[model samples]
Target: MASAAEQLAANMNFQAFAKATELHKRIWFTLIAMVVYRLGCFIPIPGIDIAAFSQAFQGQAGGILGMFNMFSGGAVERMAVFALNVMPYISASIIVQLLGSIYPPWEKLRKEGGEAGRKQLNQYTRYLTVVLALFQSFGIAVSLSSSPGIVDNPGPFFIISTVVILTGGTMFLMWLGEQITSRGVGNGVSLIIFAGIVAVLPRYVIQAFELTRTGGMNGGVLFMIVVLAVAVTVAIVFMERSQRRLLVQYPKRQVGNRMFGGDTSFLPLKINTSGVIPPIFASSLLLLPATVMGFAASGNLPAWAESWLPGMVGQLQHGQPLFMVLYGALIVFFCFFYTSVVFNPEDTAENLRKYGGFLPGIRPGKRTAEYLDYVLTRLTVIGAAYIAAVCLLPEALIGFAGVQFYLGGTSILIVVSVTMDTVTQIQSHLLAHQYEGLIKKSKLRGGRGR
Candidate 1:
């Protein structure tokens, strides 16, 4: 059966896509939406001095704000309307997920309710996104104006205009992402980040070339960086595809005097059950202090606050020992946290038992749940370590080499993971089309062992 499927996939062509009009439409729509999003990133917000803001960001590179600016595709540096990007939405979604795990009402809504409940939760998340966006926008506006010569006229009008424009931009980006998810080929949020990373790649490469030209960086080190990037990409691909297969056996049953259900299947558990989220969450948390400090540093705050805060913030800078350790710990913590939120071994066990399925070596109830949990825990540990290494290593290397390139492990992971997911979806579509072709051919042949 697998070989047949593989053959079918091999035979798939543009003809299949031509027949799949709906999927084609979706793919086109998604592309168009993404193009629009990229255009929006270039649209500068009104009433901000672009040159001054850019200069401020230059001084603040290696700080948290620069990281945020990178994620937003330089919108933050340009102080574009979409400076907030979809970060507020992501933050709100995380908050809702965390709350759903702890809050009974939200938990019940997640489990007992159906589409209606989901819609309600989504509405709530959107509302929260708007709130977060507004707050962040206000903070950002104040931060920018605090910078000397950033705002020519720092007053209520400038603040209000900036806040409104940023808020609107964020909501627009959020809407664009949702549209892509519903009408496009891949995840909208991920694609946005992928686009941002890809956009920045050329700049990083150029910077590396400049450094080498100036004799600031060794050619050997540049070669090593390239080789290391390729190696990390390969490793990420391997780890992301690695899985633990849990063997399940079904007892034979009589159906209309014929034996059935005596089949076995393996439940595949991914090594990294929580993909990308751990590092993203960890980075956001670790960078929070630096972000605040960056803003505060722009302000004429109390002497004690400025003195003590920047020093503390320096400790959390990208290559600092404290920063790496805390970042790795947070990645591990969120790996476990997000995995538990997304997967419930108890629920899986119950569903399997209800379907007359049992693990090969475990009892069908509590024991199976315990077994699954144990397996997941071990897998999560490995997954967390993989994430930590992939994420922390790049920063450490860049820091040790004293290179100014901006590419990092987290960016590479997102790019690779999203690319793989997109390819898998495309393959699935092709396989389905191939199956449809087989069915049509068999119908034409009319039995007799085609």
Candidate 2:
């Protein structure tokens, strides 16, 4: 039998949506924000020769540049203002979060302090974003200048301008994302990325068809790719939704003449508590090598150094054994690292003990914490393997088929996860709207009875 909430959700229709005026506003705001983001992807920064840059980019397109372009919705390909995207912000956030776990001051602020502390940490993240953006944009500027004819003026002026424009563009995107999170539906940063990936999806699909028409790819391979994509997506959804429920019991107690407590509940822990962070962090680290090599290739290096750079880049190329091994290892490492950062079994156990709750077969406090940790460790191991498999499969397909579709495993994960989350938020709003209508009806009935 369907629960009341489930039945109510099933019965929801256009009428309820039409009544959700706030949801409409949020949806509109999100659309407009995404439009603005897409527009920025085309707004090229000053001092770049488009033709020369395009030619140079084509050579490096199969490497890090290609991945970044996919994430930025072709912003990097166009040498647009948003070419940097929100990567600097993401890097800064990761650093801050890692510090919050190990650094004493940050740890205290994160746990002991509340909203104000969160705001402070956000400010710190923004400041660090500016620094990283400046550094990365400067390096990119130098790299562009090194490429023959890529920069109109290969001087200090051009470099400064590129750095400033790119940095400013990134900061603007960060601000835009914050606004969307506050005033619209879904996570601002993630939605920005989501919008970027989805915008380019149609073009990739068309490219696949074009490849088939030109006999560039075998038809059977394409079919297999499609099937594999579907299978992986299904697996992602299932694993993401899977959780372990731990039963907790509260002993009956008496307060005054009334009985209280004596409740039974289950504490739900997701199999993949780290979500997409592990894969994102892993990819970012793996891609860093390509970016570094680009800078080195552009520089005047010794003969030995020049010879070694090519081999290093080749070894780190997508689908190579070394690349896959490192990618999977990093994913596994981050899975456990991030899971520990986000969830403290000791804290949870302490909270449960304070509330007079205990696990069915385990004592409260230390024993409970140990039990939770043991279960979580096992789940993380499984989750790490799942994430590694999903992410690496696309790399293998790309290598085997010699087709470059930007909708890789990471892209699919982000798209599906964000879409699910947004849909859930919409349903919650619709449920709230129904509850409000019920309250109004009940109030009128009570007044009539009086």
Candidate 3:
């Protein structure tokens, strides 16, 4: 049977949406913000030779740069101001989150300081973002300088300007994302990334079709890829929605002849508690060494280094056995690690016990914690395997098929997950609007009765 909320959602119509003025405002704000981001993707940075850079970028388009370009909405390809996109911000946020668990002071703030602490940590993340952006932008400028014809004026001025422009662009994006989160719909950073990917998705699709038409790719292979993509999307949705519910019973209590409690609830645990983090982390780690080696090999390295770097990079290519194995192993490792960080069985057990709730036929304290940990461990195993399969299979197939587009499992996961989150937020807003309408109607009736 469908829940009341689900039924209400099903019955929601255009009329109800029309009445949600706040939601309308938020939607408009998000759209405008995304438009601004896309526009920035086209505005190239200063002092870069556009034609030279484009030619050089195309040569390395099948490698890591291609993946980054896709995420940046072709900003990287254009060497745009937003070439860094929100990646530095994302890395900073991840670093902050991991530190919050390990660092004693930050962990205290995270656990006890509440809202104020969160703001402080966000400030820390922003600072870290600026640092990382500066570092990355400097590296990029140096790399471009090394590649002849890419930098128009290869000097200190050029490097300084490149670093400032790219870092400033990243900071601006970070601020824009914060605005979206406060006044718009969905998470600002995620929506920005989502917009970037969706914006270029059509071109990728058209390219696929063009490849099929030009006889560069077999028609049957194209069809298989399309089918595979759709299948993976379906699997993503299903697994994302799947949950394991643990029943918790609250015993009845009597106080002054008033009975309370005596209720049952199920704690819902998602099949994939870690979400898209594992795949993203795994891919980033796996690609970093390859990217560095590729860049080094292109530069004026010594004969020994040059000879070995290219071979190492070749071995680490997408479909290679070493790459695939490392990718899968990293994904599995991060899945378990992140899950452990996010969900603490002992804390959950303590909370349940404090609230006088207990799992049926189980003790309410330490034993409950053990049971929860055991269940979560089993769930993580399945979750890890599912994530590995989803990410690796399509990647291997695409690499083998010589597909140029970087439409891998991570992209699919991000698109599906972000879409689902945005839709859910919209529905919640609609529900809130409906509830407000009901309250207004009831008050009007009461006023008239009086």
Candidate 4:
């Protein structure tokens, strides 16, 4: 049997959507914003030889650059203005999140202060983003200049110009994301990333077929890859929705003329408390070496370091044992690290105590905190293993096939998670629209009676 809410949702149709003016407006705005972002991906940065860079990029496509390129909607390959994309912003956020845990003042601001503090933190992130962007942009400029034929004119002027352009581009993208978040549906940053990943799907499909036609990949392998992607997506959905629910009981109380009652509820903790962040953080950290090397390798390397550098980089290739081990280790580290930052067992216990609520058989203050932490630690171990497996399995396939299917499991996880979140938001908006219509009809009926 369906609940009333479920029944209402089932009954929703074109008529309901047509009635939702705000939803229509938001949908249109989101589409337009996405289109704008896509257009930006093609606007090439000046003073770079596109043809040469494209050819050079092909050689590096099997490595870390491929992953970043996919996330940037091929902007990096195209050497577009948005080539840097929102990666600097993401790096800044990671830094800020880490600081919140270790730095006393930042930790206090994050935990104790509310909305205003968050706004302040966001400001700090933006400033840090500019700094990261400039550093990355300078490296890119230097790399391009050093790489033969990649830059038409290589000098101090080109370096300065490239850094300025890329920094401005990244900042513009950051501002655009903020606007979308404030006025549109879903999370702005995630949606931008989602759009970038989706934008390259057609190209990936074409590439897969091209490989098959060229006899580089057989039909069986292609089919297997397709099946693998579907299986991974299904697994991710199940794991993401899985939760541990802890029962809480409120004691019965008596007021002078009324009875205030006992109520039972559950605190739901998601299996993946860290969400898609662990892989993103891990990948970004791993990518730094490759990305920096790609941008700097063409530049004059010291005679002493040249021999070992290339071999060291080769060892870190995506699917190699060394890379896999480090990737998995980083994912596990960030899983616990991020989960602890966001969810404090002590704070949860304090809030429960303040509200006269207690977990079944547990004291409300320190004891409750201890109990929660114990459960959380166990859950996190399992969650870390799950995330590590999901993120690494795709990378391992790189050795057997040209399965450049969005670089690795991290990209797939991101695409699927963002899609799920967007759909959820749309459903929520539709439900709100239905409520508005019901309220309007009630007001009209009352007026008629009056």
Candidate 5:
């Protein structure tokens, strides 16, 4: 049987959506912002030779450059102004967070400075973003200048111009993301990436169909691909929603003349406590050097960069042994590190103690904290393996199937997680709207009875 709230939610219809004025505005704003972003993807940067860039894109489409192009909504292929996207911001954010964990002063500021501290940290991230963009843009500019026919006029002037244009584009995207988050709905940065990935999905579907029609792809093969994709999506949805709930009991209490307090509840510790953040952070880190190298050398490595250690960035190629090992390692590392950053067992334990709540059969404070940490560590191990497997399998398929699709493991996670989050927000808005209407009706009835 469904609960009353569940029943009410199910009963909601399009009429209720129409009545939700605020939600309507948010939806429109989000749509408009995304449109604006997509438009920028078509606007070329000042000095790119579009013909040469297009040709170059075809050869390097399977490399890291292809991944960048996918995330940029094909902006990189066009050498569009928004080609850099908000990747620098993401990379900078990762660096800042890593620093916060390791550096005492930064950690103290985050722990003690409250909301103001967070603002300060954001400011630091923006500064770092600019620095990173400058370096990356310069690398890209130089790489383009060195490559024949890639740059319209290969010189200092063109290099300077490219750097300035690319850096400014990334900064603009950063601001636009903040705007969407504050004025619209869902996470702005993730939505931007989501939009980029989804925009090219139709083309992939068409490509698959064309191959089938031409007898290049067998009908059975196409069906298998569809089945695999659906199965992966279902698995992702299940993993994203799975949680480990610990029972928490509050003691019965009497307050003066009234009786109160004996209620049991659950403290839901998610299987993936960091949500989609770990993959995004790990991808950003892995891609940072790859992006620089792609633009700096365009897959033809200089001797210095080619000197191989185990898992060198220059040696990275999807489905290769070194690439798979490095990718899995980074995913696991970020999963544990990010989970620790976002959730503290100690803090949870302290909060529970303050509220007179305790886990069943466990003592409060230190012992509870220890138990929570133990459970979380075990969960994290499972979560890390799950994320790595999900991510690696798709990339491996790229090499095995010989398909040119760019629906990466990380991209799928972001798209699904963001969609789920946005849908939840919309549902919450609708439920709130229904409650407001009921209140107004009750007030009118009371006035008539008066």
Candidate 6:
């Protein structure tokens, strides 16, 4: 049976994908959804003065807003209705996940119920997104209006309008993401972000050339950067795919009258089980305060407040020592935090014991749980360090290289991880299709032989 399955997979080809009508439809639907997302990013919000807003962003592009703008695919810079993107939703989801670890009610909901609980949690996340979106939009609007020469006049009406519009835009984006997830191939949120990042590539390239023309960057540095980027991308791919396999042995057991069971399997744990969450969480937390500070600096504030606040803000700015330290620490913290949230050794051990599975050299209950936990702790440390290096090294290099582009660690990790997952899904679909074809062929051959 295994040999036949292998033969089926070996024969799988592009023609199978073409013949699979449902897969084709799914692919097309995903493409259309992405196009819709891109279109939303181009639609400007009602209140913003485009010319003035553009100028303001141009100056503040090196700040926290710059990072946000990149994530939104230049929507923030263009003052688009979807300028906030789905980040508030992501932030809300992360917050809920974190809280679920500590809060008993949330923890119970997570462990006890299945689909119903998940749906309830999702509903809560959406509510949190709406609230966060409103707050952030209000803050952004107030800040934009406060910026000198950016707005014609600042008033309660304008602030209220901006907040409402931005919040509505975010909700719309959230809905769009859900549609993509239900109908599309990859994750809707990640694809939206991926689209945004890809959209700005041409601009980043153009800017790089402009820098070269202006002698801001030399050809040697440019070559080095390209090489490093490629190498880092390769490393990300490798680490993301790497896994540790824990061998599990099942003892023979008699059920009714027959013997059923001496079998072996393996528990696979990914090296970077947390994926891109750690870096993203770290970035969001680090950027929040800097964003607030940048906005405050735009406003007319007391001199004393401005003097002290700017120093505090400066510490959190990208490329600064304090920023790097905080970012690294946050990444490590989230690595462990997210890992624990996702993987429970006790639960795993329980499931294994229920299935009559045990680690080759370990006992089946508490000892098995403890062994798994010990291994996971060591693995988490390695995973955290790997994440930190991948994320921080690029930023450090980009800082030293003085590149004008905003390619950061989080963006690269997302692109790599999502791409890998999508590819694996595609391959699995193809393999299944191939096996079905093989089974049909084998049946036909058997009938002829009879």
Clash counts for all predictions: 0, 0, 0, 0, 0, 0
lDDT of 2 by residue, 194-289 (tens): 888898878888888888889988899789878988998899999989999999999999999999999998999999998887877776666656
Which candidate number has the best TM-score? 2
Q: Please list the Cα RMSD from the true structure of every candidate, rounded to 1 decimal place.
A: 2.3, 1.9, 2.1, 2.2, 2.7, 2.4
Better of 1 and 3 by lDDT: 3
Q: List the residue pairs that clash in candidate 6.
A: none
Q: Give each model a TM-score.
A: 0.94, 0.95, 0.94, 0.93, 0.92, 0.93
Stretches off by above 4 angstroms in model 3 are 1-7, 286-288, 446-450
In candidate 5, which residue pairs get closer than 3 Å at backbone N, Cα or C atoms, i.e. clash?
none
Tens-digit lDDT string for candidate 1 (1-450): 577977877777888867876777877887788778778888987777788878877877775556676777777777777788888888888888888888999989988777877888899999999998898888887876666787888878888998999999889888888887777877888788777777777877888888999998999889988888999999999999999998899999998979998889999999999988887777666555667766675567796697677677677666778778887898999999999978999999999999999998799999999999999999999999999999889879977987766678888898899889877877787688678878988888886565
Candidate 3, 1-450: lDDT as tens digits = 997677778879999899899999999999999999999999998888899999988866776567678778999889999998888887787788889989999999887888999999999999999998998899888889778888877988988999999999999999999999899989888888788888888888899899889988899889988899999999999998998999999999999989999999999988899988887666555555666677787777897787677777776766667778888998999899889878999999999999999999889999999999999999999899888989888779977887766677777887898899899899999998887887899999999999
lDDT of 5 by residue, 269-384 (tens): 87877777777776667676765555545456667765652235435656556667777898899899989988999999999999999999999999999999999999999889
Q: What is the lDDT of residue 66 in candidate 6?
A: 73
How good is model 1 by TM-score? 0.94
Query: Which of candidates 4 and 6 reaches a greater lDDT?
Result: 4
- Please state the error at residue 379 of candidate 3 in Å: 1.7
Worst 10 residues of 2 by lDDT: 399-408
In model 5, which range of ten residues has the least summed lDDT?
306-315
Please list the C-alpha lDDT of all candidates, in the order they appear: 0.83, 0.86, 0.86, 0.85, 0.83, 0.82
Candidate 4 C-alpha lDDT tens digits along 1-450: 996679779878889988889999888888899999999999998998899999998877767778788889999899999999898998899999899889988887898778877888899999999999999898888778888888888999999999999999899989988888877888888888888988987888788888888887888988877888888899999988889999988888999988896998899988889988888788778777877665555456799879877766665766777778898999999999999988999999999998899998887899999999999999999899989988899878876565544446787888988888888888889988887878899999999999
TM-score of 4: 0.93
Off by over 4 Å in 5: 1-8, 212-221, 294-315, 438-450
Q: Count steric clashes of candidate 3.
A: 0
* By lDDT: ranked, best first: 3, 2, 4, 5, 1, 6
Better model by TM-score: candidate 5 vs candidate 6: 6
lDDT score, candidate 1: 0.83
Clashes of 6: 0
Candidate 2: regions farther than 4 A off = 1-4, 404-406
